[model samples]
Target: MDHLSTTHSCMEHLKSQNAKKSGIKKSGGKERPESSFVAFRAFLSSCDLFYIKHTCNFISRRVQKHSHLVHCHLDRTIGNNAWSDLFPRARSHYLIFEASDHRHIISTLDSKKKKSVRLFRYNRTLCDNLEITQLVKEIWNTSSACSVADKITRCRQAISTFSNEFYVNIRKLVQLKDSLDAALSASLPDDDSSLG
Candidate 1:
């Protein structure tokens, strides 16, 4: 399974686990917590195709013993499966607590295998344009075998390319307007444009 389904499996397990602990009921009848999180241990049976590592990203103030407070692991790391496959020697280290009560979890990965990602912002106005609409539709139907993720990536690229061109034009227009205003001001003797 991919990251989404893997994460969904883990989260669904946690949600049900929490509900049971908090005395909350849900649909789908009663599910045993152990059976719900089969993905975690089941990976081992699948010839170690995936792995689940329990790591603490932060601390939740719960479970008080005597005069001291004990915190249980609230956040779990399910993606360690890929990490082991990429860098077997690397391990997660919990750094010292900083401004927040949560400690940072640092793990090393093969940087060469990772691709540089830039943030993409979606604007509602971009969707209103005919070009963008047509672009999205064309990309969505371009390949019958394209997965949903692939289609989304293509649409984003198209929208980003179109928006970038518009942005450049806007910048050029602003610069041209500024230059004209500067030239007009210089042509006049002073702040007065009486044309005497």
Candidate 2:
């Protein structure tokens, strides 16, 4: 939700300043009408019911072309402790004043690290295979290092290499089996005379 009262007042003040420069009588040095302030205060009070003012960091500076006023208010729940979960590290920034009358206000929320998804793939052909069992036994018995961590690392590397090689071999065997089956079907007669 954007609160534009500060911007509206700034614009009114600018208009009044321009009028004074042109020898026009200012409205008793009052830029905004009394009724407008009263209405704005009422609106703020109503907003206070649902949100608490988190910060009063004004982005625009008074030295610039615009007035330094709290045009944007960062609000959060009064009793909600889960603000971090919603916004993480929330911050406000004032971008460079460009061609616009007012400087752009930027609000940012720091993103949390996302959890990585774990994938588990199983190959039934590799299970209970004598070659796979022998490969594991050979790698596990190999004296690559004296330390347990080093040995475990070596074993993991060996198993990964073996799995890659096994997968390639399995794919080749499957292709061969499919080609042999196709050739056998093609050689068989379409008619039932061969069955007799």
Candidate 3:
């Protein structure tokens, strides 16, 4: 009964508020004289107030969510025994989320090793280097392996070595760019830092 009465009273209050917002005030039961310009201005002002209120609410909600997320983390990672065997030294780590709405979770398979985990990739820039042909020819011709697969693997290894040796300066520049990007992210974040 109390709940029903409270809801009824709230509806009455809303109706009264709507009536007050109808622009022209009643005067002796005759339609009140209100200028079109004044009515339009009143409508615009109300709309502006509503827009500002909602916008402020949205921004505050986002800020509150971001601020409260510093200690609150609810992310999950599921794997099987096979996965565990493949990556015995796997670990989970959190990534900072400043510009994004959701925090990130990273899983590193080998977090302790300082060795390069970079996979072999054939860059378009490699074609421009004139020494690539000579290196390939030397690798293919000098390989003593009889089996085709063994020869291919030997050539791949040689090419990998050549790529590393040839792109040493490029590697240094990449390191420098990464450091600069890190410094920049300290002030403003991009997509996500937790991902590799």
Candidate 4:
């Protein structure tokens, strides 16, 4: 049988065991607190399950004051295999409670694998810079490619290279300015106003 089916069977077996001990005649009736606790404890003893903390600070229960903490538990094997090649990293998301007072938990496997999003950056200030205009003109005029697509591609590559270099230079200049500002501030007199 599958893992879920096995878990279900084990839970059922625990419930039955609890029921027998409690002398409960009916199976479909509301479960008693003792029976529920026994079953839950038995299930915990049988499997290596532990609770996962929720992302939010708010309690899962309907009442804000009362803290009813329930955790999302996974098999010990699953947790162990997460670091290995067999399984990927996983995370649990606690959904908002609507119909039920308790919040529902959903485990998402391979949570570390993220979809790459490419952002195209445009520098509007480049239009005003004469150096950038001259560089673009040089790149466009120097391309030997006969086809319009190839020429456009070459120009794009040249522009991208220029933009990357420009940004790096700008970043260094900003860093230098920040350092100078910090030094100036440090060297200043502690008395409220030295200039006045």
**Model 2, range 1-196, lDDT digits (tens) per residue?**
2244322221111121211112121112225344444543454454332222233333232122143222221122221224434554554444443444343454555533458764435456666878767766776678644577766666566656778775686777666655543332332223333321
- Candidate 4, run of 10 with poorest lDDT: 69-78
- Top-lDDT candidate index: 1
| Candidate 3 least-lDDT 10 residues | 52-61
TM-score of each: 0.30, 0.25, 0.35, 0.32
List runs of model 4 lying over 4 Å from the truth: 1-88, 91-119, 169-196
Task: Please give the lDDT score at residue 19 for candidate 3.
Answer: 27
After the best TM-score superposition of candidate 1, give how far the Cα of residue 174 lies from its true spot, in angstroms. 7.1
Angstrom error of the Cα, residue 9, model 3: value is: 44
Candidate 4 C-alpha lDDT tens digits along 97-170: 44554445555655675788655465787789787788778867777555778776666666778788766877
Candidate numbers, best lDDT first, in rank order: 1, 4, 3, 2
Clashing pairs in 2: none
* Steric clash count of candidate 1: 0
Model 3, residue 19: C-alpha shift (Å): 41
| TM-score of candidate 2 relative to the true fold | 0.25
TM-score (C-alpha) between model 3 and the true structure = 0.35
> Which residue runs of candidate 3 sit more than 4 Å off their true CA positions?
1-91, 96-103, 107-119, 177-196
**Candidate 4 C-alpha RMSD relative to the actual structure:** 16.0
